[model samples]
Target: MLSESSRPIIESTLQTIAERINDITVIFYRKMFEYHPELMDGMFSRADQAEGIQPRALAGSVPVFASYILANPDSYPDEMLARIAHKHASLGVTADQYEIVYKYLFAAIAENLGDACTPEIAEAWTEVYWLMADVLVKIEKGLYDGQKNDVIHSNFKLVSRKEAGTSVLDMIFEPADSTVMSDAVAGQYVTVIVKTEDGLRQPRQYTLLPSAQNQRRIAVKQNEDGEVSPMLHKLEVGDIIEISNPYGDVVLGGYSDQDSQPLYLFSAGIGIVPMVAFLAELKKNHSKRSVVAVHADSSSEAWPLREEYLKLVAELDDAKAISFLKDGEGDFQGEVRVESLDMPRLASVYMCGPLSYMQSVRSALVQQGIPGRNIQYEIFGPDQWILRATRRSMRGNRV
Candidate 1:
């Protein structure tokens, strides 16, 4: 535990470290592509990287992590951790890869900070990185250990594939061996690993759609631009996919145990996956908690789980669905446009989807004076926001 006397200094040191990390992340990617040409294969989106979004997001995340540690240690922002873990887990990033990232990160820091990179500062930052890496390594190990001990990886066999709707697939994974499939919380996800022709394994995640509890299944919306998604879409029945045990933090347990509070779930496109899962669990448990589900897509056709969401809504008196787009058609109902949504009675607002959509929703919520604690979000990739937010808070305190 960090002592009260050491808290301020540690916080200050962490702030500096966050600044340095922002520098390191930018340079690390440049060096990675230069030295590790093979790693670019399926590991990064070239177009997105070229657009400078993912890189900038990663650079910003270091500071957000520092902020979370100093400002909100109790919760530790599960949303941020879940997002990064999902991305890393999807790629099957190992403890070894974390070390690689740390190496490149520190090296770039030393290079960028130059005269400012005093030995003392470098050591302090390295200690912080190691501490963080150790924690992440342990968490990741727990996931791996669960898969190994429970043999969740061996249980799933692809039984069939059907076109749920344009590019979306309903994949059934039946137990091949006697391994009992672990019952997953509806909104949790599983890491699906596919062995490529080059013998390198690439992993992706899909939202486990609600189906018969006895059989494990998932709904995957294939991304043509994505390497893993396209390959996943191509798999035929009887094919095998290596899946890790279900893992995710975006769940609905908070309301189930407590008195019913007005819960609002906001999702866009594929972000609806976890929400669907949560609704399923709530229905199965027969919890009468009030939930308002609002989903937005580019069009009605792009919405991933339209039928299932409707079915769940029909069964539950407290559940409702609000669609923002219909087959490329834009908003019409005008009942709190995705950009305009802000409700005070909402006990918890869980958001998932693209960065822009999440950002827009977050901004609108903030404008409505919704406390950060009341807003939970799930992002799509590595966390740079966590570090950035922390640094901003630190700067405010200093001022």
Candidate 2:
């Protein structure tokens, strides 16, 4: 619903904004930490700051905001927002902290844009920023409400930890106070907050492994490249880490008419986490649903929850697991190209993975004349590219 009248001005302003991304993010983070240092404990990783990952990620979100404002205002995807909510939820981030972020963000923009930002330009960008913040606020509000009645950090205790298949660690969280850990859908994840040796707090999200509702388990693969995952790998059985209530949009649909439609779930690497959760739900409800669950990993060693996924697919009469690489596997019968999807019969498609893979899958579906409403996916990183994609796609649709 982006108005034709304002679209040109919005796009023109965005060109300048995208160019000053690094400066904006750098100044914004500096000011944010200066005013609110406590947030640094759980939210921003010191290691990532030293290595420049957090700054780069924030810089990348600029274009994403532009694309969203310039294109379909009626629709905003929940994937990126959900990831942030879960990350924030893990560390118990609050609305007050988000307000702090907003102040620094706008202040930095004003400083960086300087005289080049005229009244119209300033107003337009302000509208865009508020719109983006509003979306985030609504999402954050949902997370707050969801966890309102739940206990914090005391229900689950770390039971055991061991390397599962190589990079992934199979860590079990047993109920300490309540035998009923919230029933986690297969594809959903939980945020684990651990106290680092430097006394800085760090949070990381991991996909839950298959288990009865009473026992909550997750596959913690060594994120050698990330700050929190490495710390997570070092934890022991008796160690207690704060667990956030599970929050994700990738869960199974409600028991409506839509539940019976043909469902296709796609995942790459750790993206398979949520897919497993969805499959488990499908079984418990005795769903007569038709599903095609596919996972792509480098090899069997990286195929997290291999046995569990296979077990669910086997029992479900209509489900199948399309594996890219098996045990000592060489190759597949055919490369898992998105172009091969039978879009006409598909009710909905859920996908999670690298952006390139999702983009390819999105393109394939769009090329086959599938409606945008039928396609869904998630991203774990900043989402400025989403705006770029929307702008390009909308312009192409008009032509």
- RMSD of every prediction: 4.3, 4.0
Candidate 1 structure quality by residue, lDDT tens digits, 137-236: 6666666565534453453678877866568887888766666666667667776767666665555556677777556788777777675777788888
- Candidate 2 lDDT for residue 185: 58
lDDT of 1 at 41: 54
Work out the TM-score per prediction. Answer: 0.79, 0.81
**Tens-place lDDT digits, model 2, residues 349-378:** 788777777777677777777676677776
C-alpha displacement of 316 in model 1, angstroms? 0.5
Which pairs of residues have clashing backbones in candidate 2? Answer: 64-384, 67-387, 185-277, 186-276, 186-277, 187-274, 187-277
* Per-model lDDT: 0.66, 0.67
In Å, residue 397's CA in model 1 sits off its true spot by 4.7
Clashes of 1: 15
Error of 1 at 255 (Å): 1.6
